[model samples]
Target: MKKDLIYSLPVLLATACSDDAEPQSNNIQCIHPGEDLQAYYDLLTQNPQVVAAMNLCERPASFQTLLWDKVREAEKTGLPPDAPKPQSYYDFGLEMETKSLSGVSFDSNQYQKIEMVENAEYDFYFPAKDGEGRKLIISNQVLERATETFLRNQEEREPIKTIYTTKEEAQEIYAAHLAHSLWIEKNEKVPWSIIDYNSEQLGELFGTRTWFKTWDEKNDEYVISLVLDHSPRETWKVINDIVDLEDLTDQKAGVRGSAGYRYSE
Candidate 1:
């Protein structure tokens, strides 16, 4: 399904007890991938919620140090055998041109230029339309082309830096890295579908809906439920029966897996 769909689940909170304590809610706060980074960073310095979610003290320097330490650890151990590889960053830029029609005093001719900022590579162009109010449309077309080109080019690059190691460390880094990267990548048009659905697809192809859900940072693995709303129980059984057959097939031929679970009533 969609990453937004998985992210929409209710945040589960852990509770504590005390003799004179007020009732505590278990709502664990989470930061959306699209939230403003500077604001988030600043909030991390001031907000208890952000600090708790990141499992850090309310000090930015401390958090940075912790992250750097993890990076060094990953570099030393290498990523886990099954961890997804890291991606690279790409920058995008846009340019636009417009011309008024001759004698007609009407807007007509328009052109747009879009390129990757890093390599100065031109990727797309937009031309004007023919209509009574063509000038207005052409202007919009130019802006839209520029925006679209930027988004497309941005999608071609990886959203974060990653290193491989053991499954345990990989899991931790994956969760932490994804949490941060998701925020940075939101609305930037990078690949979200790839990170969220590969595992689910693999499960479906194998006809098995049950799989292990391991946190990227922790050793805990939970049994998660996976099924399309329209999927049948017999189909699931078939997948379960042939789960081992995956190794016999081309490793790269199947869909990737995701990290969350879903249930339907």
Candidate 2:
């Protein structure tokens, strides 16, 4: 059977927050990693070896001289007096917007660029709010959710032969996908976690458990499980008992996967 994302690592790296920070709790909402990553930055600053090892800073100071020279040449040539102002997605929809040639203290990017959707007409539907399609440095959990969502929606949903067959290849591809998803964030107007696990519970609405299996070659057995919620077979048993003996209005449905919604505490 061609299965999708059942036992696979997500495109997002399943990165644990730095051990320096508190261990992440399962139910609590995760803080956006970049918003207040001062601790992470401090750790990197004290350890030059860690920075070099991670390659967090990709370029040397001199490398920008080439681009800077070109920019300086353009500066001497001066922009036309009637150069167009930066356009927002609000005005252009999905079409590309023009940017101001002259740098300013305030720019169009500061404003919200909302496009119409069925549920919410004024929605920033594009990746990366500025629409510059710039890349972001992201944490592992977000990357994993991004990857899993991507894999969950593909047409063929086949494992990449190179990655599936070799352990090293798998790690390389996983890292690349994490980086790619980060870049995708730069192109959009907002950022949020995939907010999955609810979909796992959605399965029981039809009297079926959503789970997947993988071969355990060393043990010579097949392992069956669900990623977000464990042992759907067991969870379904409880739901079945509830339906047989009790009225649901008096009892909150309890499931292991969903954090708290529609599931008991």
lDDT of 1 by residue, 1-109 (tens): 1212112112221111111122233332222222223343333333333333333321123333434333333334443112222111011121123221111111224
Candidates' C-alpha lDDT: 0.30, 0.27
Which 10 residues in a row give candidate 1 its minimum summed lDDT? 86-95
lDDT of 2: 0.27
Question: Candidate 1: misplaced stretches above 4 Å?
Answer: 1-40, 57-168, 175-182, 185-212, 215-265
Judged by lDDT, which candidate is best?
Answer: 1
Error of 2 at 142 (Å): 53
Best by TM-score: 1
TM-score of each: 0.20, 0.17
Model 2 per-residue lDDT at 20:
21
